[model samples]
Target chain A: DAGITQSPRHKVTETGTPVTLRCHQTENHRYMYWYRQDPGHGLRLIHYSYGVKDTDKGEVSDGYSVSRSKTEDFLLTLESATSSQTSVYFCAISDSYGTRGYNEQFFGPGTRLTVL
Target chain B: SQQGEEDPQALSIQEGENATMNCSYKTSINNLQWYRQNSGRGLVHLILIRSNEREKHSGRLRVTLDTSKKSSSLLITASRAADTASYFCAQPGTGTGNQFYFGTGTSLTVIP
Candidate 1:
């Protein structure tokens, strides 16, 4: 798991409720990412952070927001949970960016969030 | 959008048989990586091959990269039941960003 941990390993929430997932890393990597894994979709990046308080949207950033006040923690927030948001979420960390030719990423155990 | 697509979504083989999975990606990339995911768990890094390299090996795993064909293949020799899991290939996006897109993955079921 690369010393990365996600909070609320499993959660069941109601629709229209707000949910937040936390990712913490001990490696002090430069990059952190949030991704969702669904059937037929391997893993879709929701958001990523390059440094403290530096965040960016990913391909599937809509309906999701992220905050990175510190280097080791990145939070993904769903303003309003929906049934479609019920999926396994994973957190990943990398020592360097892919464009820099360092592309190895380590993933967390994942958090299973279910919306009713 | 996904940068890579894996062929043969599912595979089944005997313990002693070999399994090969292929991945095709769009656009140029600096490197490609393979990962394995067990049911209900996070992925584990397997091997990484750079664009400048043709083939790379690690233990029983062999990976080949064909930049000319925009494809790569992962071959697992002497399969085992414990090897049953989903395998995915990932590559950095074409743009200058750091995002890495993953393929749909191939589910391998190794029979004991």
Candidate 2:
């Protein structure tokens, strides 16, 4: 199994507070992604990094931002938390040599955030 | 806004029974993959089927993809209580990047 870990497994905060979730990987993979899961909705992409310092937004990147200064760490930040932002967040890393496809993603244990 | 949708939002089955989950995508994909998730945890990659391939298997898990119909199905045979988890289908976006669009997921319950 790939070595991936997510920090701050659970958190609860005020509506306007700022929250940061961290994803760390030991696999030295080139691709890293952040996603959120909610009831009745698929896992939606928030942000992703293809290389160090290279990141892009996804379908639901409205209130979130990400930064990757190193190959092993990807950080996700919510500038101002809202009730709608409360969901289980996941971090994933993909390698090109996995199998049939050029890239296959492996996920880290998620972080559960609740904005009260 | 979702690229893929899974059928049968939830399923409950007895141990030793078969559980089949289906997923459908809206766009052209390079490959489709399946994942499993325990409650409030990260997803685990189960299998991947390429656009040109029709079927693949790993142990008791069988996956079938119909690119013409833009659909795929995951079958877990002889289910056990340990097989209880949420299943999701992911379609890799068309490009060099590694972004994956996921389905809503089907929650499975295996009653022992």
Docking class of 1: medium
> Tens-digit lDDT track for model 2 on B4-111?
899899999999999999999989877899999987668888998888889999999999999989999999999999999999999888544578999999999999
Span of ten consecutive residues with least summed lDDT in model 2 chain A: A95-104
Tens-digit lDDT track of model 1 for A51-74: 888888888888899999988899
lDDT of 1 by residue, B53-106 (tens): 999999999999999999999999999999999999999765434678999899
The C-alpha stretches of model 1 lying farther than 4 A from their native spots are: A97-101, B94-97
lDDT of 1: 0.91
Q: Candidates' lDDT values, in order?
A: 0.91, 0.91
What fraction of the reference structure's interface contacts does model 2 contain?
Answer: 0.77
Q: Score the docking of each candidate (DockQ).
A: 0.70, 0.72
Error (Å) of candidate 1 at residue A74 is: 0.5
